[model samples]
Target: MKKTALITGANKGIGFEIGRQLGRKGWRVLLGIRNTLNGRDAEEKLQSLGIDAVFVKVDVADPDSIINAAEILAADGTRIDVLINNAAILEDRGTTINTPRGLLEKTLMTNTSGPFNVILAFLPLLGNGSRIINISSGLGVTADMKDYAAAYSISKAALNAVTKQFAAALAGREISVNAVCPGWVKTSMGGAGATRSVEKGAETPVWLATEADSSLTGKFFRDKKEIPF
Candidate 1:
């Protein structure tokens, strides 16, 4: 049977590119989006390109939404081979001193807690040899931490920790869980001046999802190479 992958925030940017590439590789791609209209549009676009793509309504920020999506997949008996936690937000680019408390909380809610909740809801569908790719960032690395984008950075750091915890928890099950930094891609979150293209940004995650060694888990990666967290 063809493998299946679900990518949150898959309506655009690197998430969309990951879906497209994985679909091209003959994997069934589930486009997880908050908006039904956008998800349908993305699904249709992928289908137009001869990809087996489906739209799954998922709002990672909302626990109910994540649970609903998991229920839908469970009802369909969808066995997810890969789960990409690509949904994230960069609400405030300000320094730690200037970033609002509400913005930090909101950022953590979406980027960190949301992925954790999704993983929990869908854990049953994932089995041995399954892959979990959490989209993190270089800013999340404490060794190279900076002051800018404090909210976004902090959330991603927490996400990396989540990856490590899950890796340990799932070690006996043979499920691989890791984090990848897509680099400074030219997405809405990365802005217009970023250097990398969406395809380039999606490459590592796609590789991790399909081609990386199953034995490899609980690591941070960038450009298909391991990096320090």
Candidate 2:
């Protein structure tokens, strides 16, 4: 049977590239976007290439939206083999010390809590041997800490902790949960000076979703190699 993959924020950027690559590999790609129009366009783009793809509307920042999305998919009896939490934001342009009020809260809502909500809401749809890939960032790595995108970085750090928590919680069921930093890819969020392409940025997440050892869980990865969290 063809496997199914669900990718949030998959209408564009690295998320879209990951879905496209997985679709090319014969996986049923579910484009999880908050916007119906863009999601349908992405679905059509993939279908034009003879890839089995569908659009699932979801807004990770809102728990209600996520819960409703889960209900719809469950009603369809969908079993997700891979779940990629790729939706996030980077609106904080100030340093941690001088960060404005509400920026961190806003970032955490979408970046940290978003994945947590997505995983919990979709938990029933995921079975044994399923994979959960959180598209985190090098900015989140405490070992190589930086002050750029203060709120965004802090949110990713929390997300890494969340990954480990779920990995341990689901270990008995053979479900693998891990975090991946896609690097500074040239996406709308990554800006124009980013050195990596979307294809390169999507590589490790795709690997974790499809090729990585099922036993590898609760780790951070970049370029398909393990890295310090």
Candidate 3:
């Protein structure tokens, strides 16, 4: 049977790269885009490469949109073999003390709440042997060297916590829940000066999706190496 995969915020950036890679590997990829125009563009781009790609509008910050998408998938009785929660946003890259409440809220809503929302909404769609790959960041590592991105860091840290929660809840069901730090890639979000390319940045997520060991669950990876939880 052809494997089904859903990639959130996949219209572009690391999400787009993940879609391309997974589709090329013969998975049926659902690109979860927020806008119809961007969704169509991404679908066309993937189709040009002869991928079995479809676009579904999913605004992570909007619970209604997430619910609707879940309803459609549930109606179709679709079993998502892989779910890549790659949708994220960077708001106000500023110091910890100087970050405004508005920026923190927006960042948490998107980077933190968004993935958790998708997980809850799509829980029924995930099946035994399924994989949940959360695209996280090194900045979220509270044990690592601290950064000034108060909002982004805290949001991802929360994501890390959520990853563990899902892993525990899904463990008996034989589903694997994992998180990966894509590193600073040269995407629009990562900026032109970022060290890594999209391809390089997507390596860990792709690996966790397709090649991770069965023993590895509820873990964090950076560049294919497991990091401290």
Estimate every model's Cα lDDT from 0 to 1: 0.95, 0.94, 0.91
Please write out the lDDT profile of model 3 over residues 1-229, one tens digit for every residue.
Answer: 9988999999999999999998899989999999999999999999999999999899999989999999998998888999999999887677888998698899999998999999999989998889999999988998873758889999999999999999999999988999999888999889999999999988888888888886689999999999886
Model 1 poorest ten-residue lDDT run: 92-101
Angstrom error of the Cα, residue 76, model 3: value is 1.8
Q: After superposition, which runs of candidate 1 have C-alpha atoms over 4 Å from their true positions?
A: none
lDDT of 2 at 79: 99
Ordered list by lDDT, greatest first: 1, 2, 3
Q: How many backbone clashes does candidate 1 have?
A: 0
Residue 189 shift from truth in candidate 2, angstroms: 0.8
Q: Which one wins by lDDT: 2 or 3?
A: 2
Lowest lDDT sum, 10 consecutive residues, model 3, at: 141-150
Clashes of 3: 0
Off by over 4 Å in 2: none
Q: Can you write out model 1's per-residue Cα lDDT over 1-229, one digit (the tens) per residue?
A: 8999999999999999999999999999999999999999999999999999999999999999999999999999999999999999988887889998699889999999999999999999998889999999999998888889899999999999999999999999999999999999999989999999999999999999988989999999999999999
TM-score against truth, every candidate: 0.99, 0.98, 0.97
Q: In terms of lDDT, which candidate is strongest?
A: 1
Q: Which lDDT value does model 1 have at 59?
A: 97
> Residue 76's C-alpha lDDT in candidate 3?
85
